[model samples]
Target: MNKKRLGPCVTFFPQPTTLVSTIAADGEVNVMTASWAGIVSKTPPTMAVSLHAGRKSYDNVKQSGEFVVNMVPASLAVEADYCGV
Candidate 1:
C-alpha cells in the first residue's frame, strides 16, 4: 500500500453549483455563480450562500433583500461555466 499526506484544505466533490439571481435597486437582474451554498434550515426550508463584499450581487442583495437560487445540472456545464465567469 502507498501512503501520502496533504495539508489542511477544503475539498468537496460533486458540489451543486447554483446561480444566485438578485435584483438591483434599479430593477437590473444580476446573476452570479455560487458553489459555497447549502441548506441552513430544513424546517423553514432556508439556504445560505456566501458572497464577497466586492461582488455586485452582494450589493444587490443588500438593497433588494431577496434572491433566487437556480441549481445547475451536469447537462448545463457549459452554461454554468459561463455564469461562473
Candidate 2:
C-alpha cells in the first residue's frame, strides 16, 4: 500500500465581502458590512452573523427576522464597507 501526503498549511479568505441590510418593525432600515457570516444550518438554509449588540443592524435583526445579504467585489469593496455607516 502507498501513503499519500497532504500539502503544507495555507490561509485564505472564506467569503466575499457582504453587506447585510435589515429593517425593523418601524420600517427603519440599516445596513451592516460583514465578513463573518456563515451557514448555521443546511436544513433551513439558515445563516449566522457576528454582530455586536450596539449596531443598528443588530436591532433590525431582532425586530425583523429577515435580512438581505449582498456580496461585494473588489471594485465595490469600499462602497460596501461604507454601508455599515
Candidate 3:
C-alpha cells in the first residue's frame, strides 16, 4: 500500500459549520461563522474555536469574554456559507 503526503494547512473537512456569537463592550452583537471549532471540556461544557486575529468576532469575544457556538444544520448550509464568507 502506498500513502500520499498532505501539505500543511487548515484542511480539516467535514467540519461542523458553526455560528459564533459575541458581544462588544458597548452591547453590540456580532456573529461569525467558523469551521474550526471543537469541544474543549465536558464538565464545564466548554468549547474551543479558532478565529483570525483581525476578525471582528475575535475582538468582540475577547472584549466581552464569552461566545455562543451554534451548530448549522444541513438545511441552513447556504446561510452558513454566506456568514462564513
Candidate 4:
C-alpha cells in the first residue's frame, strides 16, 4: 500500500467572514471585515477578533468599549469585501 504525503499545513482560512462594528466616544462608527475570530467564553458569549492596531475599527472598538460582530453570509461576500474597505 502506498500513501501520498502532504507537507504539514501552516495556515488555513476556514472561518466565515465577519463585519465588526464599533463606535468612537464621539459616536463615529466604523466597520471592518475579519475572519480571525472565534468563541473565547461561551457562557458569556464572548469572542476575540484580530485586527491590526492601525485600523479605524480597532480604535473605535477600544474607544467605544463595545462592538457588534455580524456574520457574513455566502451571498454577501462581495458586499462584505467592499465593506471592509
Q: Using TM-score as the measure, what is the rank order of every candidate, best first? A: 1, 3, 4, 2
What tens-digit string does per-residue lDDT give for candidate 2 at 1-85? 8986767876467677878889988887778888688778999888777787788887788777788877678899877877764
Q: Candidate 4: how many backbone clashes?
A: 0
The lDDT per prediction is 0.85, 0.79, 0.84, 0.83
Encode model 4's per-residue lDDT on 1-85: one tens digit a residue: 8997778966786888788888888777788898688889989888888878898888887776788989888899898998763
Error of 3 at 51 (Å): 1.2
The pairs that clash in candidate 2 are none
TM-score for each model: 0.82, 0.65, 0.77, 0.76
| TM-score (C-alpha) between model 2 and the true structure | 0.65
RMSD to true structure for each model, in Å: 1.9, 6.3, 2.8, 3.1
- Give the best candidate by TM-score: 1
How far is 58's C-alpha from truth in model 2 (Å)? 1.0
Candidate 4, residue 18: how far the Cα is off, in Å: 0.5
Candidate 1 yields a Cα-based lDDT of: 0.85
